[model samples]
Target: MIEQEQAAGLNRQQQEYLDVQGYLLLEGVLSPSEAVQYRQQLLALAAQEPGRINPTQHVRWLVNKGADYRKLLLHPAVDPWFRHLLGDDYALSTLTSNVVRPGAPDGRYHTDFQDRVPEPLPEFPLTANSLWLLDEFTPENGGTRLVPGSHRWRRRPPPDLAVHPDEIRIAAPAGSVLLFNGGVWHSSGANTTDRERVCLICFCLRSFMKPQFDFVHYLSDEAYAEATPELKRLYGFTAWPQPVDEPAAPKRRL
Candidate 1:
């Protein structure tokens, strides 16, 4: 059974909603100005890499690209919930952004960690995700769709299950953050509008899991030096250390 600690970052009502629905949308996590700033930054970055700006553009390793990106790693609004769900030792798996352009088709309905885990998914969450809405999400603008309580299914959705009957499209203003369990069934809605939809995805996993990006090696010396203790932990510094073998004696027999 999942722990129901009253001291967790979320209040009882918010916690209950997540437990029953498998996801929660926190409004006003970012101010309107902040959201606009992030949206512009992401678009500018996307422009630099035209090859990636397809129907759905993905900009990866955001933390390495800018100081602003690093701030979201420990954003006050969402940090506590991560600790409550994944524990203090959880590590960031990936910091990336997704931009769904106009005319983009609907994404497949699936769970986040489905590919990594086995059948009969574990009761406890192995990972969690936060979608920082840089643009207002609307039914006509490629908002995300999710099935309530799908996290408890303990199995992956059928390949033929194009759309679940219970699936609902999210509609929210910019600056809202959607937090969900990794096992929840979800997909991105098609963008029928003329404008592009953008969001920053912060996917996190238990410290034991292998992160999507090798942040430890990829993080620059300058960035690492400037990182706070909490940020260092989020970057996987607190994960179990890998064993390093000593060099073998120089070829004495040669």
Candidate 2:
């Protein structure tokens, strides 16, 4: 758990909202120009992929993409929540961008950690996700749909249900961020507009949880060398034991 002093980034009201509503919208987390730049960069990367589909596209492992993407690993507006929810040693599970094309359909409602953890989810959050909006989010433009207060449900949404009565679509400006507990039931809304909706997903989990990608092993040497200590920690380099062959080096705790 994070010490009270260290978790001072959020105020009592904000904390209460998250604890009760399961999600919080942080507006103006990025400047309008920055959001536009990220959108362009992500789209350019997506365009490079072969056999790309129209409905939706996911550009994964963004930390290796560029310096702009790397800066997001420790964005001041978003990092504190990760520490508050997952404790001081939280590790980033993945940094990926999601593009919902004009014809994209509504996504399935589910929690980020439900598949990994057993049924009857824990009372506390095990994971947290921050959606950095690169374009304005609207109901017609595939804004995220979430069931308020569902994080405390302690179970997954019903598979057969198409939409819950309590579900509400989130609408925010381009530079805003939607931060939520991993247990909240949510889905990407359908995109009916002519333009595509873009957002960078920064997902973090407790240090003990397995990450979606093995960033420590797969990260390029250059990237590792350039990473700051906080980035290294977020990449989970110190959260687990490293493999060794022959005689092991001097033992040390993570």
Candidate 3:
């Protein structure tokens, strides 16, 4: 869904869509049964331990729930998109499973590159998000809210009431991944449902900075002690030394 194209020319389609729309929705990225299982496990876990949510605000854990959640994290369809979007010189990383339970307060819209960027407002984005829907994301549910194409505007995220009125909603089936640039101003929509709306949002960067979640610390000693190299790498380990000698990339403007 996000891989770049290489034919001795610019990736006209992805580049154009990203430049104008700010986000690309990939439908049917996950099947019905797959969505069911993903939702089931996540809801069960969320119920078993309500504390698993974000300590500060949302609830979340970094564990291998099942095949549906694991496989999609490193799916082939997304590979091409990442390859083109973030050059080969980079790597893909996932934080602990991000479980935002129902009733969690709506999140403020902030740039994902705030710390990295020298300026508070950069023209373009350095970070992107892959939000994997575990349950049906409805406009009413705590579906992630975004101001489409705000990535280029370089403006502050508006309050929810101002951008999305009660009538306008964003929902997607289970298994779908909403990919967008971090610079795009957005927020977490309030969950109006009785049940929880779970998700595993991965903030993949260009392999040059520290991960938001320290995968090594989150994974229990027993879990990481016997993990495979592939698993370790996915959790933030690297087989070789990473490069950081080059200067930071230029910022994009609206």
Candidate 4:
């Protein structure tokens, strides 16, 4: 159980929302200026390698792209919530962005790590996903479609439903932060609007799971130097066991 002090950043309502629906929308987590800046940064990066931008597919390792990525990495508002869900020993598994271009195709509904992990997920959360909206998510603009309470399901959702009754189109303004259990079923909607829809997602997991990105090699020395203690730990400078346990008995002379 999360202690009161550990979960202080989340109010009663937010906790209840997460507990019941497996997702929560945090409005105004970023300012308009911040949102614009992030979107511009993402656009610039995409322009450099336009071929790499796939519709509804994630672009990995935003940390390797710009300094602003670090801001989202260590945002205070999310720290406590992550701690509440994943505990202090959690490690950041993935930091990536996705852009749903105008006329992009709809994504298949799925869970993040559920298919990969073993069956019968533990009662407590092993991973949490934090999404930072760089553009307003709307039904016409291709907002994320999520199935409320689907995270608690032990089995995969059937694909028969073109639109499930429980599915909720997350129509939220830019600068919002959407946090959800990694087990929740979700997908990107088709974008009919004229502009692109941009967003960044951070996946944090319990120390045991292998992270999606190899941060140790990806993060530059300068970035590593600038990283906070928590960031350093998450980046895996401290995840390994320092010294191997010594043998109880000394080796016999040959």
Candidate 5:
């Protein structure tokens, strides 16, 4: 049961849509200029490690890269919704950009977390994914495809059901934001266009799960020292054990 007031970031209609569809597309959350800037930054980061770019997967952990990337972690438009769905103690598990080049192979349909674990898919939202589209998403450009309500499905998608009738491709302008539960069935469409398709994906999870990246060790000391309390917590520094007498709020060094 979603409370409209508790989900103030989303209206009743939007909340209902997410409840039924398992995902939501908030169009034009980032301005065109911001989109271009993000695309440039992400591509530049990719250029730094050109050899690492793989056909099906081209991702780089970016929370500690630059101020721009760090600021994106707490973007006003999508952060509230993540907190609402994942709770205040949720962790920003991984922040990486996906670079899908022209002619890249189709992404196999699957959930982010469910496939990693055994059968009897877990109930409830243990993790969530927020995608920031840096380029316009279209069929020719490899827009993402999702099975509308499959997030609630108890079983993994069978191979025979790969071409699901209920699946829909998301086509939106640059700067749009796409968010979904980790259990939602999804895959990237094949990129047949001449240009590259870029998207920043933020994988968030309940604090209890292990994060994909080690933020505490990898994050720059300077950045960690200046980060806000909330950002610090999201980076996992505050997630480790703490004294019983200490207040829940993170303060001082661990």
Candidate 6:
């Protein structure tokens, strides 16, 4: 169990909401100092990233590359929440980050996974998006935009050029880490502020699910060797066989 000091910090119904709606808001979990460091490392990374942007001119698939920024990927809150949802055998996809420069446009509303299943939603869900807000996620700053309960229905709209940027905005504070089920309908909002908005988005999944970012190619053998066994398991090193070797994985401590 989380100690009273820490557990007391989380709202009572937050985890319940995450389980049912595929998302939850965690307030005040990060320190201002942490946010400052995250922004520093990510900005430097974004400057060096060479990949093509998705119409946003920001970096993507930048986990292993941002080694210094990995702390955000392994926060105390994230581990407990992720273990609660995905179980002990799960792996850390990577340390995903992006620097949303000023004038970047609002994004499309859509689920983060492939659209295929029964007419209605599936019995179970897969995929999770853990976003560590390095800046104030304000309506004016282009914080992530999400429909409250769209995850239950599995519905979303494409990036609507017509919709005003403010319509679906969610303003989160600098220390707030937003954990949502991947199927939740949402999009990255536009940054109107002159300064850049940097975010550390860590993708995690059940041990058996295929990862979104290619962890295999992103991590080098040297990094893997230096990483501890737990870190290795988090990076897809220990292959959890098909059909699930165990049920829900073992209970996790800390």
Q: What is the number of residue pairs that collide in model 6? A: 3
How many angstroms is residue 17 displaced in model 5 relative to the true structure, after the best TM-score fit?
A: 0.8
User: Candidate 3, residues 47-147: lDDT per residue as tens digits?
Assistant: 67756445213334444443444455446655444444554433445543455556666666665654445544566456677777767788777787777
lDDT of 6 by residue, 32-111 (tens): 99888877866776667666544355555555564555555556777777766666677765566666778888777767
**lDDT of each residue in 1-254, candidate 2, tens digit only:** 32572466677777778889999999999999999999999999989975775688889989888778888887888887777788888999999989999989899999996685787999999999999999999999999999999999889888877899999999999999999999999989999999999999999999999999988778876678898888888899888776587586764322
For model 3, the stretches where C-alpha displacement exceeds 4 angstroms are: 1-15, 52-68, 96-105, 113-116, 120-124, 155-169, 216-234, 239-254
- The C-alpha TM-scores of every prediction are 0.92, 0.93, 0.71, 0.89, 0.89, 0.78
Against the unseen true structure, what C-alpha lDDT does each candidate score? 0.87, 0.88, 0.60, 0.79, 0.81, 0.68
Report the poorest 10 consecutive residues by lDDT, candidate 1.
245-254
TM-score of 2: 0.93
The best candidate by TM-score is 2
* Worst 10 contiguous positions by lDDT, candidate 6: 245-254
How many clashes (backbone N, Cα, C below 3 Å) per candidate? Answer: 0, 0, 13, 0, 0, 3
After the best TM-score superposition of candidate 4, give how far the Cα of residue 33 lies from its true spot, in angstroms.
0.9
Candidate 2 CA-lDDT value: 0.88
Candidate 5 structure quality by residue, lDDT tens digits, 51-107:
787764556667777777787776778876777668768898888888888898678
Which consecutive 10 residues in model 5 have the weakest lDDT in total? Answer: 1-10
lDDT pick, better of 2 and 4? 2
Off by over 4 Å in 4: 1-3, 159-161, 241-254
Residue 62 accuracy (lDDT) in model 1: 93
| Strongest candidate by lDDT | 2
**TM-score of decoy 5:** 0.89
